[model samples]
Target: MEIKEVAYDHPDAVELSDQVQAEYRTRFGYDDTTPLRPSYFDPPRGLYLVAYENGAPVASGGWRAQDAEDEGYAYGDAEVKRMYVTPGARGQGLARRILAVLETSAREAGRIRMGLETGEALPEALALYTSSGYTPTTGFGVYRDNADSLFLAKPL
Candidate 1:
């Protein structure tokens, strides 16, 4: 598989992101009323990475520098976001590959740590984060009071 930088507007990237959001809603019973906005990807502080195999996008992930209000739990850090691997690509370590790329990018950006929030229902994701050296962290970002959310962080 090959990893590449992707713009939010990339066709495959946009489609895969939509699929991911749908999966999140299906798996965790989240309302589809509030979509993850496109503007989240535009910035001086965000990085989006996509992984491809056989000329098709299979996985993607990104990180953004934490905002001032996020300092309580994510100071001097970047927040991992939008991690997803297509169903056909599951169990192939594609997610891990995407994560490695994102982590490297964050380190290159001078970030000392990385944090993320995943739903408790995603056992595979929880396992992946734990095996990748991330540890449980206090709530962060817009998910501070979300009961189904599990936060994790790793020092870069």
Candidate 2:
């Protein structure tokens, strides 16, 4: 797979984002409503990545700087978002590749930690994160109050 950094709103990114949102609706009965902007994924502060196989977009993930004390984030934290692998691309380890790239980019940008919120409904995500050395972390973000929300973090 070929992984490339791209704007959050890039055409391919948007298509994959729509797919992820649709998957979210199928899994939790509603789409994720996190307030996100393209600027949030801009370089130096954040980044978004897309992975392609045979020139077809198949996986994506991103990280945004998050340091709001009131929001329970740390001073040098990077929050992961929009991680998804196309249904047909499952089991190919593309998600892991994208996640590794995201972590490396965030680390190079001086982020001290990486954090993310997933859901119980996404067992594959939980497994990938846990196996990647992410540990349970204090919940943050819009879904923090949701009983099904699961937060994880890793030092970068």
In order of appearance, the predictions have TM-scores of: 0.88, 0.98
lDDT of 2: 0.95
lDDT of each: 0.80, 0.95
Write one digit per residue (lDDT tens) for candidate 1, span 12-58.
88878888888988898873232344455544466787888899998
Error of 1 at 133 (Å): 0.5
lDDT of 2 by residue, 12-72 (tens): 9999999999999999999999999999999999999999999999999999999996888
Question: To one decimal, what is the Cα RMSD in angstroms of model 1 from the true structure?
Answer: 2.3
Off-target runs (Cα >4 Å) in candidate 2 are none
- In angstroms, the error of model 1 at 103 is 0.7
TM-score of 2: 0.98
Residue 132, candidate 1: how far off, in angstroms? 0.5
Clash count list over all predictions: 0, 0
Against the true structure, whose lDDT is highest? 2
- lDDT for model 1, please: 0.80
